[model samples]
Target: MPKSKTKKRSGTDATENRPKRSRQSQGGTPVNSASQGGGDVEARESPLQGHKCLWIMGSSIVHWAERTARLDDPQLGFTKHNMSVKWKGCRGLVFDGLDKLMDSMLMEMPKPQFILIHCGSNDLTSEGVTGKMLIEKIQCSILRYQALFCKTTIIWSSILQRRYWHYAPLGAGKKIEKKRTRVNIAIKSFILKNGGQYIDNNNISAKEVNLFHTDGTHLSSLGNSILINNWKTALQSLINSTPDNSLLTLPTATL
Candidate 1:
């Protein structure tokens, strides 16, 4: 759960069973960005009530966070924000796999208010893949998702730099880095142009050493914390900037 309210643009009268601040978030803008752990002072206990939902989707980086930080735990960081937060990711998942994953999600959950995607790193490392090819595929997939979920917002997260390219040959780090940069720039451009938010992870690099694990593909604990903080900042800005949402607070109910 986030320390923010669900930005519900359209829906039937959802039972208002959240806190007072969440109810207020609907009429006015919210400005709380719980940078890092423990979130905001408004955070509440489990079983929050909300109409909109959030989904954080990706591969290793996301999966690692969920495994170590339980980032998806709906009760972990519920500040006045009234949306249920869920995490979906796994190790070695590629871009195409992401499409399948999201499609599968439709069968299990309602349309989400936001979906944060942080995948494509694995595909970047796979032999014979070029940035151009990957970018085209990603563009199609993202567009499909956007068209299907007309009301939902899409957040395109950039790929992180790796100390090592898993499937590439020795000393191919630089080549992979170049491709990754090109892919990120191109993707970022498309996302911004076509109505999507972008989160850049260039601040976290393999060069930092402290930010990465020995495996070089995953992030260290401290690294994940930083990544999450960045997300908080970006998402809070996006949430607060949106206009005209009405929220209500009824008795608390199980998620």
Candidate 2:
């Protein structure tokens, strides 16, 4: 007898006969189907994504640096989203006050990837807070930031010089200017020793200052732009030194 011939089923028939996937049934729960894979993928990505730039202002800087960053370099990627009062009313306050301010600011916006600290001029000119005290305050701020957010790049601007040197009861005009220089020197030293960055506006001349501002105290629109531009350069320099992968390992801890 001739072998019996068998006919193959049509594709449509085979598909119709195949096992159907149930909407509610589990091969794996739909909600969790990609959970493991997605989580692993996210874990592999760097934690520094969405990091924020924070500007912390002392009393003088509250009026100066913060305003400059806001109006001049809105593009600098820093927001008043974080501010701290390191000094008060034309004078530097107690060192403890700075500590408190840093703690509170960090708690409120903890993941700052970059921090700009502007102070010391007030300390020297107003309260006569010594270079040692200023250094202590700066060191405390650095240590606190490092302990809480290791990835943050801290930038401290050098003490700015003044056009009007005499504030009654302080001293002769030139004497005050001398004090400003001393404070600026101390600030630069502290920055260098601590592995932080500094921006020197002290070297900015009277002619340059006049171009940026009408008032001796604050900068004009052009001045603000200059200030922000300098700061941007410093920020870029810091970024160039840090690697994306390494930033992920930055510590996040409570003060």
Top lDDT prediction, candidate number: 1
User: Ten consecutive residues with minimal summed lDDT in candidate 1?
Assistant: 21-30
User: Which residue pairs come into collision in candidate 1?
Assistant: 3-81, 4-81, 5-81, 16-250, 17-250
Model 1 spans with C-alpha error above 4 angstroms:
1-50, 71-79, 244-255
Name the runs in model 2 displaced over 4 angstroms.
1-52, 62-73, 77-97, 165-171, 206-215, 242-255
Candidate 2 accuracy as TM-score: 0.59
Q: Residue-wise lDDT of candidate 2 within 7-125, one digit each (tens)? A: 43211100112122211110100000000101011111124455455554454434554555555354454334232222112224434465556655555543555556666554554
Error of 1 at 211 (Å): 0.7
Put down candidate 1 lDDT per residue, 1-255, tens digits, no spaces: 112234432111111222222110111112211111111112112233355577889897887776655645532353456666788977789998987788777757677777889999888767677889999988888788776666566787788877656557656667777888999899877776666777776556565666666555678776676677556656665666635322212111111
The lDDT of model 2 is 0.44
RMSD of each: 16.3, 29.9
